[model samples]
Target: MDKLGIYAVPAIIAAIVVFGAVKRIDLFEAFREGAKEGISSLISIAPSLIGLVIAVNMLSASGFFDIAAALLSPVCNAIGFPAELLPLGLIRPVSGSGSFAVLSSVLEKYGPDSIIGKTASVMAGSTETTFYAVAVYYGSVGIRKTRWTIPCALAADLTGMLFAVWTVRLFS
Candidate 1:
């Protein structure tokens, strides 16, 4: 499996080159153009990525997550969800680093073997950083208006968080 993984990309690229040759296309030129396009896309998306990082840092520093967690605590407790895991779930969709920071704190406080910690691990594992991904991908592609992307991704994240807790509790 490890050896196959190591050869996967080169195999895929070789297949592409062969296919392009059969199509009478300039494979090297196409590859070079793709590299250039990728770089430009990276350049275009860099600001959004940097801003996301900064915004996450600011939010983390401002204690806003703690306030949100506190406000949501009662509801979470009633639902049998740990209030401590609230911040990680809420932040996961917006910023991976921010959510991971929350997860790290939870692990530190609760220990990694604790129920909350296992749930956090599963939540982080199962969910995507929706807003961050959309911001970078859309911005790079010059998309100004997004339709249903945020809502759908957040819905998935919420569902993932619930399942993470449910599955963990099922085993425990």
Candidate 2:
């Protein structure tokens, strides 16, 4: 299985090349065009990606996440959610690495078998990096008006987080 994984990508690439040849497609030209498109897409999304990274870093450095987590503790506890996982839920949508740090903290403190650790692991696995996806995909396409995207994505993230907790509680 491990060896198969190593060959899988090369096999896929070889298949694509054969398919393109069968279709009489100019592979080198096609590859060049795709590379150019990718670079352009990267250039288009760069500003939004940079801004998001800076904002996430600023929030982390300013202790906004810590403050928000502290403030949200009461609401979380009221709903039977573990307050320790609040920061993970908050950061998961904006930054994967940031949420990962919070998840690591939870695992270290609570142990993986603990309810909090299970919830954190589930939340991390289930939730999307909402802001990053929106910025990258929308920006790459030059879509400036994301009217319903933010609210809808956030609601989905919240649903995933809540379900993560409930699922852990229900199953464990």
Instruction: Give the TM-scores of the predictions, in the order they appear.
Output: 0.60, 0.60
Clashes of each: 0, 0
lDDT of 1 by residue, 101-160 (tens): 667667876899898898999999888888878999999989989999888888888889
Q: How far is candidate 2 from the true structure (C-alpha RMSD, Å)?
A: 7.7
Native-referenced Cα lDDT, model 2: 0.82
Candidate 2: tens digits of C-alpha lDDT, residues 1-172: 3366479999999999999999999999999999999999888766765666566556667877678779888998899777778778778998766676667666866798798888899999988789999999999999999999899989999899999989888877
Q: Rate the local accuracy (lDDT) of all candidates.
A: 0.82, 0.82
Off by over 4 Å in 2: 1-72
Off-target runs (Cα >4 Å) in candidate 1 are 1-71
In the predicted model 2, the residue pairs found to clash are none
